[model samples]
Target: MGGPAPPAGPGTAGLRAVRGKSIAVLGGGSLGLYLAGRLALAGHRVTVALRPGTPAPSGIVAEGDEQWSAAVEYADIGRLRGPYAQVIVAVKSHDLPPLLPALAALGDGATEYVFLQNGIPWWWRGIAGDGLPRARQVVGVVVQHSAERTAPGRIRVRRTAGDRYLCGRPDGSVDAALESLAADWRHAGIPAETTPALRRQVWTKLMGNATLNPLSAITGATVGELATEPATRAVLLAGMAEIARLAERDGAGVDNTPEQRVARSAEVGGVRTSMLQDRLAGRPLETEALLAAPIAIAEEYGEAVPVLRTLYGCLAFSSTSPERNPT
Candidate 1:
């Protein structure tokens, strides 16, 4: 029911067409705050549900290519109660478990649960399979915004241009609410849209992530370094080729070639990947979803992803072993 518009597209043409809707963002990370701030500016009543003990800022401030600030209500995720128009689950896959009950509870009244995770959702089989009612809708977002938290309640959007937020339901069904949100996001200066080819979008994003993220974390390289350095770049291209093959076999082929994906990523310049940031900060890496799950899928299809496997082993070992602990 929707697609991408040309650059310089839909500049607030229908900004006031849709009324403000209630939205609950379940994370206070860079992406979550950026979205919350933008949504509030779009006139939505946005509440960012932060993790317990995390300070709630009086307002959110965004910097870099895009700049703005907005006020949003905050709540401890554990104690969050809601009947918002939609609930955006913006946390990583590893942090999703404890939030399941909140989701199940919110499912009863919220129009949809929008998952913003990177790798395959555990609920891919069916959101309802997790005991969510069939009547409840679930959406997936493929985020292209390269951002990081610069300070409490502040987000630094790293990429200078071409930030797109692609959303779609798992069943590829048309979602009017999402379409409306997309339009408003565009008007608010964030490139966003909904697409029927969501699975393709997921695979396409995964192709880049699987290739760049692990390499970045392992070598402490930024996106540009991984793309330009011959040794790292070779491994990156090899891994991307493997994932592309796997995606094709699964019937959700990536849209671009490995080289094209890498070239596009090079545009991001020296921005550190989320994985690399997590590694440096001593936070748990999302290896299971980003690497293990894909590796498992490859194994099931009798596909070999030796480069990914090697990267995964190194990352997994470091994440768990004492060698990674700061003295």
Candidate 2:
């Protein structure tokens, strides 16, 4: 209901104080590599924990309009022993399970866990339903940027448009650590802020993802392509309406109309959706988190999500078809 809190201290100098603190970044994906490079460049001691057998690169290289390179320490997930200032989980939602037990092994009360995945994360539901351990400090991060890994330990960040990041607790509580992390990210030129209403932010982003992602995967179309076509646009709006209803039922206030969301997507132009990329790459689609989870929530409330259900069925089938080969 309110805006983000102001930064606690002066500009880049205050953010620089975050340096020297140890951070363990889980997952060697695009976003993860980019964050590791940025934090390392900000002078923090960053260690990236990749899956076993992943080639250990000498350092991470970030490229786009401007280039940034930072030397980062590397470790296998099984080898991580952290009493770190923060442990950022940036893996795809579907790839999260195997890493969970390893993360829990880091000790219950030792480190702050920051999850940067898209859609509804598992921890979010735990916080809302069963509640996480009191000792663990969990922060939810919503990243709004276009980034892709060009190679091992190399990433290209295409856009840092707008307030590109949001971090907060699931229970709508203010957190000083989250605010400081946001400030550090901001100092690194990634627009970021700490909000009390993180779930609202999650729902807002989820509204667009629920509709566009699966539709793009099914049709192999770009966001602009889907937005400009009348039939696809209709399906998009219908799916968004269903999700908006579900959001209201779940107690998150999302105040944008379907048309407004479509307009916003149109402005993003030809960028391919992540689901489409995963589908083409023959990787496991994030159907559960982006589609199935929302559908389950809708069913729990006895709400109809005909469009969403149809999309989910199509994606689920495609994800399992023998014709598709894993890359």
* Clash counts for the predictions, in order: 0, 0
lDDT of 2 at 258: 86
Which parts of model 2 have CA positions greater than 4 angstroms off?
1-18, 104-110, 127-136, 322-327
What TM-scores do the predictions have? 0.91, 0.88
lDDT of each: 0.77, 0.76
For candidate 1, lDDT tens digit of each residue in 1-327? 466643432222433425788888987878888878877877888888877788879889877766667789888877766677778888888998777755767645436777889887766666544546343367788987789887779987765455678888777776677687677666655667887878888888888788688878877778998898888888888998988988898898988898998887788888988888877777777888888888998999999999989989887776776465323
Once all C-alphas are superposed, what RMSD does model 2 give against the true structure? 3.9
Q: What is the lDDT of candidate 1?
A: 0.77
Instruction: Give the Å shift of residue 24 in candidate 2.
Output: 0.8
Model 2 lDDT tens row, 144-220: 66677777898766652343678888777876666777766666555677778787778788878888998898888
Q: What number of backbone clashes does candidate 2 have, counting pairs of residues 3 or more apart or in separate chains?
A: 0
